[model samples]
Target: MKGRTVVLDHIQGREAAALMVDGILEDFLIASDAPPIGTIYRARADRPVKGQGGMFLTTPDGPAFLRQVKGLAPGVQLLVQVTGFAEPGKALPVTNRILFKSRYAIVTPDAPGLNISRSIRDEDERDRLLEIAHDQMQGCDYGLILRSCCHGADDADIAEDVSAMRAQAEQVMLDPGTEPETLCDGDAPHVLAWRDWTDPAEVATAAGSFETHGVLDALDVASGIVEPLPAGASLFIQPTRALVAVDVNTGSDTSLAAGTKANFACAKALPRALRVRGLGGQITLDLAPMPKKDRKGFESALRSAFKTDLDETILAGWTPLGHFELQRKRGRVPLAEVLK
Candidate 1:
């Protein structure tokens, strides 16, 4: 709907730092302060619940499990936290929790009673997938985070991806690939396009095409493009973790608000401000911290902007910082990426 920037953080030695900024996206930056490790998620292993083995952690980014399976060996059980290692040409243990190294979670089942439990029309195909997973499991136990591509994927597709991975691992023995080299990747850019299409806010600005210079139309959030900004309407974009400040200069004729009018204007335009400025995430409006008489009007402006007609989304009360706060939904991308 609005023109925004999404900065994706990659992983570093101990932190993640990647930034994806999209101001219409033709001129975009997928900058990284570190490695492109993607997002980290918390997961709980559900099936074949083991008392001794490790628990699987599934995040939006990838799949990792904490192994304590050896505790089943009787006597005093030892709960082991295994951070898996990938070695070329080395056989994996049955107890090892080896997952596809990726930025997204795509787990499949390999252990007894933990295989894909869903019914399938083709028994042979299902058995084949399970067998493939079993073979990959090798020496010890393992868990798989099967990607979405696994859905309706023939045995060949899985075999190709998995085999490609295995072959790449073998190549590492002859000549190791660069750490930054692509090992496994997720869905294509068009899939991302489809996700943005479902949201209704992504293309809200551009009815025609994006300009050759890469400036998109003024955004309308969920609606459509409002009115296009006249040429020479300078836009200054400032981004913060919680809020984004967009200073719009309406040229010489524009008048600065004297009293409560400014607060009222801001309140009235907050929703559109969020949309056009791509200002989602945790947001707080400072508004110069106006006087008590103007406070009610400012709060009223915020209430009007929510568009949901519910009190659940807006925090109408004052805050400790003397600024009014608005808890809006986090957008697909961030503001800094767009603004930058």
Candidate 2:
């Protein structure tokens, strides 16, 4: 872990990991891939349950449980977004208005009764349901997590996740069967690890160039670098195994960002993270060895670069060997499309 580092810190009966780079705290991850719940599904209407709760909508799987009016107003159709599970290991029949709770999610054959279940009810609550679905689709662009990655996230982040779910659902509605039975190819463990980056704060604050400082630039740099390569590079990228190696050599003559040149150099390197799209692992950087006085600026620059993916980046101070340690987030293999 040269440029990125992650240290586990236990807080309040739970374990919270602090991501740092060159000794700066960036992001934190509580749980990994918990499950997708409350995702909307376009389901066929099952007979309404007179009492107890709502109807059991027929999803791609089988009957999905729905609540009639949990979060709806009285006299309204009580259109609640779909929630609950169907039978496990059941392939859902693809049909019109088959079964879906909202715009965010669809009931997949995988893990129906388990987590990642989908279903939405409440006709009047369509607005809310639509909102969630829309968010789910655009969540990655907006730095929001999918419901599968939503556990222990704060309210604001959770809201982003809900939105991602909705957005994804809407896309399904607009064009059916864009993908096969599965929406996404099963992502690798590293992809889930990388998704832990992206600070909600960075998404909120900072505009334009400045706003791009945090996860945005990092992701941008990583993606840019990794996607465009001559075929058969023989380099395989993986969170559990793959990592990027960066070596910073101080120019013989100091002509770059004066005063805190070391820090400035680190700033310049920020975009490289995104260009390469490296996540959930270590990146080692050997900073151009500078005099003791130039150290402060170098430290500041390193800290600032992490704000983009602050949620998952870790910075540990220079090591005795004079190398900087950084732990970045890694995700599933970059889609073949992105590589081109």
Name the candidate that leads on TM-score: 1
Put down candidate 2 lDDT per residue, 1-340, tens digits, no spaces: 2255434433233323334454333343332222122333444455555676555445443444555424422222211232211223422222222223222233332222212212223343434443443544432322221333333334455455455444654465454532122232222222323444432322222224212233333333333333221221112233323455554433344554332353355555553333234243566665555666766666677677666442356776777887667765433223122323
* Minimal lDDT window, size 10, model 2: 227-236
The parts of candidate 1 lying over 4 Å away from their true place are: 1-56, 63-208, 212-237, 242-257, 289-291, 308-313, 338-340
lDDT score at residue 294, model 1, on the 0-100 scale = 70
Model 2 Cα displacement at 337 (Å)?
11
Question: In model 2, what lDDT does residue 259 have?
Answer: 22
- Model 2 stretches with alpha carbons more than 4 Å out: 1-243, 251-263, 332-340
**Predicted structure 2: lDDT:** 0.39
Question: Could you give candidate 1's per-residue lDDT for residues 58-111 as a string of tens digits?
Answer: 323333444454333322211111222212232111223323332212332232
How many clashes in each structure? 41, 98
- Superposed by TM-score, candidate 2 places the C-alpha of residue 109 at a distance from the truth, in angstroms, of 19
Question: What are the lDDT scores of the predictions, listed in order?
Answer: 0.38, 0.39
